[model samples]
Target: MREVAIIGAGMTKFGRSDLSLIEIMSEAAIRALEDAALGDQKVDSVYVANMGAARLNRQTAIASALVDQLNLFPAMAEAVENGPASGASAFKNGFQAIASGMADVVLVTGGERMREVNNLEATDFVASMSHPQAEYIYGVTLPALAGMFTRLYMDRYGVTAKHLALVAIKNHANALKNPYAHIHQAITIEGILTAPEAVVNNPYIADPLRLYDCCPVSDGAAALVLTTREIAEKLGKPIVKVGGIGQATDTHAVHERPDPTELTAVKIAAQKAFQMAGIGPQDIDVAELHDAFTILEIAESEEAGFFPKGEGHNALEQGVTSLGGKLPINPSGGLKAKGHPVGATGVAQLVELTWQLRGAAGDRQVEGAKNAFACNFGGFGNNVVTTVLMREE
Candidate 1:
């Protein structure tokens, strides 16, 4: 079709916000709109992504509320819900709107006010995305699923708890440099894993996956202003093009998968995205995988072709995924420390990549980075949205 470019990206600090969901999203929208400086141009439409405002916040019609609150009268407004991948799903919709010649400019915003509910309620709400009869009826939460996956992956690949701890330590250190990151507390290996009080400190939520291994329950919002290349030229900023978008799905039940350790959807989605971008995993300078759990970063890296099968943790051990490594992964602190507001996370990945390409990521910047990739995993790999973005100087 046509080329689409992100002109601006903005996100609120990902933490417990007392702001209403609409207010949070609108704030981010206004910031992104200002960043784009779309002087006389009108916003053709708005797509809001969220997962639990209806159930947790007792609200609905979030997109309508956002557009109205921002005073974007008469613009088309629609809400998208695709579990945790909701952000990328909504972003894909915006890309289609611009690329198909339907809209000149689209505002894509994803948000969640998850802190409105207690931790137990939040976990249950996210668990609702699982298969109703097969998973939810049996009370399967995401952490328990991830824990099981981690154990199986370890058995197959020889990954250990120490490697998992290394992931947490690295991401937490990265988060200290990110002002927008939710968890600013620096965690040491001794404190979390090696200390005598480690059990009390990093207690296991599920076997082999402790509290520190999990992303926190957070509330936040992120937004992007996307337009065609022609519009981007007038915006007078460096252009970060949406090179390719790919999405895929797998079996709904974790037990039904042919190989429990393999993330087939991640592999398929990454392949489609790379083919569309006309690049392979080797071409990516930086990446942000859906590290809601530390093991996911390692698993997704392998499935996304960044490493040989069952060798992702080896790369981690070699420092290949660190900030100054050959290919930096999750330089934005990832969902591990940056926080996973479910709906907000996918868009936040794009926001971080846009900043990295623009040379504005500050302390977490990947020097000379040009091509970046993001994978937003949803519902234990049942659904995934992968994106490849390129900077055109």
Candidate 2:
């Protein structure tokens, strides 16, 4: 297979958006195309990733609408949905399109306008990803699952609410440097957990998970332009090769997993990506873990091989995952502060890493970053897609 590299990346601010889903996606795509300096060149294919436009916005065939909106009529258009992993799944498809010699230039864009519906309805729409008989039938929301997972993790790993708060504080601070992050407000342990008004300020959403522990429901889009290495070199852009991509799935229901606290899919998928990239977790300079909840940051860090199984919280307390640390995680604030726009999240993670690799991430940039990693968790860790990206010298 031919090598595939990302030539351009762009994203919309992660928050409530007035623009329609197609329009949001088009905006990100146009920015990416312009970044690639396509100069009127036609794209060979366009892949759109989204989770709930049909359910929330009452729209379908979004890929075709985006093609028309962008005037890319003849381009092969398709929509991909893989729960919350939709963005990365679409990206994998686009990568295969180029690597398999079927297409030269591919546009992969992901967007979700989840705020169009009420908060409760939006939550239910996302909850549809759960198992039909085991999870969704009983109304097992994502937060409830996360809360239980957090409680179990705390028991096994000695992670406390303070450690979770550290994740929130660190990511929130990083988001302040990210112009596109959803929550710009800076938080502190005192404000969220320790202060007298903490109870009212950050009330419990689930038993152990509080309001601040969960990612906000957001509307946003992100896009990337991928091409052959030869084309990337000719474009005179920074070559950020798709070094490796790996995906894995666990049981349909989280309860079916052998160990509920262990993210087996994340571990297996990350190992595949690292092996394919000819590297290991130690070689990753920066990472973007799907931190939909604060506990996930700790759990995924361990599962992705960045920390020991039960010591991820220790790494957190030691400042190892901070921005200036040896391995800064989530320089773009992750799903915690960046907002979780389900469909857009996976693509957004890559967009952030592309910028990190290119040294273009303004304030949140990780200095001298050469290799980056990202994990896009789906369906409570039942499905995951892991990626490795390297900057070519």
Candidate 3:
């Protein structure tokens, strides 16, 4: 396979967007192309990742509309949906197109207009991803699944409510530094968990999981321009290679797994990604985990090989995942506070890692970051996609 490099990354601020889905995507796609400074190079293919546009936004055939919106006729375009991991899955498609010598320049963009619907409607729409016969019929929402998982993991790993709150506090603080993040509020354990009336402030969304622990529904789009190494060199920018991409799936129903606490798909996909990158978790200078729920941050860290099984919360307690710590995770706030716009999140994680590798992540920049990892979890960890990037200085 030929080497591929990322030359440009762009995204709309993740929140309730006044623009339509296509407009939001156009803004991100155009910004990415402009950042690439492609000169006269024609885009070979365009891929859009979105999970809920058809139901939430009353729109379909988004990729076709996107091409026309940008006047990029004659270029191939398609839509990809893989639950919440749609963005990374679409990114993987673009990466393969370049690596397999099929295309020279591919544009991968992921976006969703989920906030267009009310909270209840949005919840129902997301719940549609559950196993239809075994789970969705009972109206199993993602938060409910996450809550059960959190409860089980806590019991097995001896994780405390304090540990979960720490994740919220850290990610919320990180979001304050991210200009494009949706939630700008900084949370504290005392305010959300320890105070006398904290219960009222952070009511339980699902048993053990509180309001602050869950990511808010958002609307946004993120884009990246991928090309051969030669194109990146010609563009005159710092080199950031797309080192590896891997994906895996688990049982559609959580109960079917031998161990619900173990994120089997995350472990398998991350291992494959590392093998392809010729690197290990310890070599990662920075990382971005899917933290749509706070406990997910803890669980995914272990599954991704950043920590031992059943010991991820210990690492969080030791500050191992902080911005100034040994392996900073989610410096862009992650989905916890950065907001999860369904399909846009997977692509956004890469955007942050790319910025960190390039030393462009202003205040949240991981010092001397060279190797980066990202885990995009989809459909309650039933599907996952992992990506690794290396910076060539």
- TM-scores, one per candidate: 0.99, 0.99, 0.99
Off by over 4 Å in 3: none
Which stretches of candidate 2 lie above 4 Å from their native place? Answer: none
List of clashing residue pairs for candidate 2: none
The sequence of per-residue lDDT tens digits that candidate 3 reaches over residues 193-248 is: 99988999999999899999999999999999999998889879678999888899
lDDT (C-alpha) at residue 364 in model 1: 91
Per-residue lDDT tens digits of candidate 2, residues 1-393?
A: 999999989999999999999999999998899899976557999999999999999999999999999999799999999989999999999999999999999999999999999999988888888888999989899998999999999998899999999999999999999999999999989999999999999999998999999999999999999999999888788899999999999998999988999899999999999998999999999999999999999999999999989999999999999999989999999999999899999999999999999999999899999999999999999889999999989
lDDT of 1 by residue, 31-89 (tens): 89989899999999899999999999999999999998999988898999999999999
Worst 10 residues of 2 by lDDT: 33-42
Worst 10 residues of 1 by lDDT: 230-239
- Looking at model 1, residue 314 earns an lDDT score of 93
lDDT of 3: 0.94
Residue 99 displacement in candidate 1 (angstroms): 0.5
